[model samples]
Target: MRIPSTRTVPTRSRTAVVDSVWSDAKEFLTQFAQESRGATDTDRRLREVRSAIEATGTYRHTTEELTFGARLAWRNAERCIGRLYWNSMTVRDLRHLHTADDIAEQCVEHLRTATNGGRVRPLITVFAPDRPGRPTARLLNEQLVRYADDPRSRQRTHLAQGLGWTRGDKDFDVLPLLTRTGRDDTPRFHELPSDAVLQVPLTHPQYPAFASLGLRWYAVPAICDMALRVGGVTYPTAPFNGWYMGTEIGARNLADTQRYNLLPTVAQLLGLDTSSDRTLWKDRALVELNLAVLHSYQQAGVTITDHHTESARFLTHIEREEQHGRTVAADWSWIVPPISASATPVFHRYYDPPNPHPHTAFVHHASAADTH
Candidate 1:
């Protein structure tokens, strides 16, 4: 019943390659003169970075390794620069050489070349004002102009965007307020961009599938469990039961339980009688089941945060359970059966330690004859 401990050697080689590519890109960017158009610099740098990255075998290995999230992160960073270049060109001073259409065309051409003659198109959508007073396109244009003229505009733009203030107006503040209050007021500026949406077809569809499966089945639950334990006490405004239901919370809970070997107090909190019979059992059972599943994950080493300590603890728990004469069910076996190659079963130990002893040995033996 002692579960074997396994070690996973962390792979830093891939990360090292990515760092090398980044260094090469920084060197390439330094060659560009300050007087040159920003768009031109961005375009040249993106192409150079991509080329350098591909040359280093990072991109190829990631693709082969099916590290879709990493690949997507790289692609998105390049795309963001490309989009920024276009936006800068459109709002550039007349003294600057390139036209908006010219810059846009250059972007499309670069994408096609990078993708090796793949179909690439830019789509544009419009953003309208929201109720309780929203900003107009004119106001947004003014803000864009202000941003274009200012030297510190890039930082400001990032801040504004992060705050959901894409278009400068009263609605920018309004949207954040509404979001904080959990009120969905169909705020303005939520619409798609005015220009075309750039569509990039992925090379392999199954790559995404693998990335999604890992996050949902493993990463997410662990993250949820951790976040809840660390931040739960302070944020008691909402019912802990409702909070636990969220994916983020669930993930944090799994992580915390695996790491600390402790179940969330929220489960016990939820188990308390809340006047209504329907509400009490439903809430309690949900929390307890989540805790049970997390325990199962820990025992199987599927979500163990620290292998050195946790693995030992898990094996000890398994051994104790076995000593108590518990049987492993098919659903709770940690080892994969030959019959079902794909199924990942949970490891669980069932035992009752507090039962009283049944027999009085002295009375049953010679002590009874002596008394007679």
Candidate 2:
């Protein structure tokens, strides 16, 4: 899954509920109820959902349907390469929550449960959806734990300033949760407690001095802003996460030129000749950086997957899905590891095109902030 950038895109209109949504909802309810319970009361259940939607421009999903939908969304995530564990995900229904404080508290709870004492589990918290006249609260952070760079710092990223983050001694000072009360509401920032967050300071087994770099990351990668759509209803405040593949942190978050951009800094520390791109100094530093990320997370007793191991496991997942007679849809650009693409098993194959309508899906919701 693509991590949301801090930059806000311009808003258009609230997404219209899917066309033929009622029919689709009925089909899903009928099929799922029949398969799971051998029930043929789909016509009745379909009327139930239809009545609710026609009355309120929305419908409610039963606990069974909600759980199944959440899992299906993970299965349908086209950009994600970790669909192997989609069935094992834990879904928390927080559709009752609407206030900013309530939403913030549940978000904290999600982090605690997903962190799972460093044995990270795939989890999602589904918050209330935006109704015809009532817009649910929204979180502004791309991930639950992201840093704020000083506006004056040369390394500041595109969307750094004006989120009410204070400058610190280091570039990576953790930012508070920024949320909006309603669709038209101004954002409010809340400071998260230290205990609620579990962070692993980066250190290298080979380069003992790497600890001095003051790099650290949160245990959970909880994404709090994406919309979770299931059976024609859209929950705008749903937050979810799976455990990290180390390259996501080392290669993209920390090393991307648009992000922390730490390759030059690390290369300087490693005494690499940065005078020429011909020397492959960046490539060398990247390897060491990833090494530090893996080593640090492991020593800290956190769950993290290495690219080589994860690549092989992805293939195993593909085989298993095929055996079950399910198509394995994938995006090749995302399936291959950021580093050493040719070395992995996922590099040589073409994936089936994504199915347009999966039982569940993560849909991007244009933020109210973007409208102004």
Candidate 3:
């Protein structure tokens, strides 16, 4: 969630051994066993998983096991800054669904469920996983919903067009979902119902002219690029989401040169001197843009968090996890807010190394088109 920066994970190009699968399963199950206080038969479960992996080249996770693993994956995502509410995520077991039509519908359902009428909820929908020699489906879009005709979404936008999806004229147009059921299967485009997408039109709290820019963003940032790995099984189509952090929208998505690049426009509107970067015109505009994003989301009653608040919450999260004797891994460079680096509490502290932890999900690849 939080539409994290690029992260690379070991992709499952070929089947791994039983030992590899069991090792991850054991670590995950051991934690669950502790939570269960030995109520569940851990040893027996481990034996079954090992045997299943040996026989089928992959094992299955029960709904409970899957839910537990999904939660842990969110918890172990070191690049994410919004892990404070990781345990609140709901895991949808759509493993039985593999058809392009079925997976497409569930993805829409995921959007509706996560959107929650703008009170977005954290959720993940696990579709069919890659088998020994049979790979499952993958969503081509970086996110379930994104603006069309933007630099960030050009590749996917073109891909959708190639799939017979007509491009929209406006930059804020939502792209269709492209689902690939198998390696040989042609990707199908699925149009998202307009009701499922809740967008907040941006406006500055102070500047009336800012509203005319026609800037807005989708409410839910459901990321679909990351493959969900738990116990050696890889669910290539597991899409998960958390609410946005304000700076992610303002400082990165809107302000970054590669993204919407709205700073120059905001500066012009504010009548700031663009004659030189020495005037800090860009800095002033960046802050204003970030403010507008946070302000507009609040005005629209959508679920969003400001960087200052999220940073403090992340610190609180570290403290809470430490109390339970769990190591909360974090990448300091990724965790720190892009703006106001010195003001947040998270800026002063160090964290665990950004190593790949077992049972985690975030492996950003599509770069969140059109993100933030």
Candidate 4:
């Protein structure tokens, strides 16, 4: 099927109103400068910057502040059980980039770097934000690599199949990055080169026949649609990712019925009786599927965390944060693993009420596929 064209968004100025800019700048600088050495001098500089913002209706973050804020956002992520490594996140400042083409190239580069030849790394790349004359830039792909599901569409132009993978191929397809430079700009789609994406074909250690299933998945899950909010400034096109926890793929991505929904197929292949829930065929297939994911990633020399170990590590994270006198806010639904929820310790504990972290946070955007 040929890819559908998107409508151009009308351009509009986004300069912060004078009063709001003044308030946000003053609030942010006060908190930022208070934490740095030589507070008196930094406070004076803050006043000067605030005055400039009042006059110009905008301000730029210093490299130090940008780095701090980006890391803080990760630290503030309530749904992430992997925030134990939040401090280790690397920030790439690309705020100067204003074009979608440049952003797309950098995003591809991000995938390559984070892929790390199978050992993934946590990282984020900041892009330009909406300003007076510039409309916000955006990436249309949910992740750098995601499968497309529409089968009946007529438009088939690009890639080997002329569209995404056909349903008969188990629908393992790669989506091109679609983006627009600004609200007024025309959208364009760019296909990712094969060398840049690292995928692991799944197989079981005990069930050698599992290899015939032809199941595979990308190594890194780089989330690309969220806006990064730092010190009251919003960057609509910032893309970020942490290394995967196994269940994110095994239990959720591959097992979810709306997604690949391979449990019934696997059960049939394994010769298990699936006439009723009492047979526990679904449960048996789920265990094998997760095992295949973990084993395959290990065989491929990739980084992945088993849900059990990660759940324990999350407790350690909570303790460390508590020792530092910081409350660890978390959503119980997200903190618990998708499968074997009652089997993990995180399932039994009560956590601090979820609250916004002052320094950093990863916030969601509307579904990218819905935006067009």
What C-alpha RMSD separates each model from the true structure?
27.7, 7.1, 7.2, 6.2
Better of 2 and 3 by lDDT: 3
Across 296-324, the per-residue lDDT of candidate 4 in tens digits comes to 99999999999999999999999998897
Scored by Cα lDDT, where does model 2 land? 0.79
Model-by-model lDDT, in order? 0.26, 0.79, 0.83, 0.78
lDDT of 3 at 30: 74
Considering TM-score, where higher is better, how would the candidates rank from best to worst? Answer: 3, 2, 4, 1
Error of 1 at 79 (Å): 31
lDDT of 3 by residue, 67-149 (tens): 87788888888888999998899999999887778888999999999999889999999998866555666788878988886
Global lDDT for candidate 3? 0.83
> Which regions in candidate 2 have their CA more than 4 angstroms from the true location?
1-19, 34-40, 150-170, 357-359, 368-372
Sequence-dependent TM-score of model 4: 0.86
Off by over 4 Å in 4: 1-40, 150-170, 356-359, 367-369
**Model 3 ranges off by over 4 Å:** 1-16, 36-39, 132-134, 357-359, 364-372
Error of 1 at 330 (Å): 19
Taking all chains together, each candidate's TM-score versus the true structure is 0.17, 0.88, 0.91, 0.86
Off by over 4 Å in 1: 1-272, 275-282, 285-372
Per-residue C-alpha lDDT of model 1 across residues 1-372, encoded as one tens digit per residue: 988778554458656766655553343243222212333545655565567555643221111111221221212221111111121111111111122233223323322322222121221111111212321111111111122112323343444456566554421121111111112222122222323222211111212222221211221110000000000011101000000112122333222443221223333333445456665544443344344434433433332122223323434544553685632122222222112223212123322322122110000112101111
User: How many backbone overlaps does candidate 4 show?
Assistant: 8
TM value for model 1:
0.17
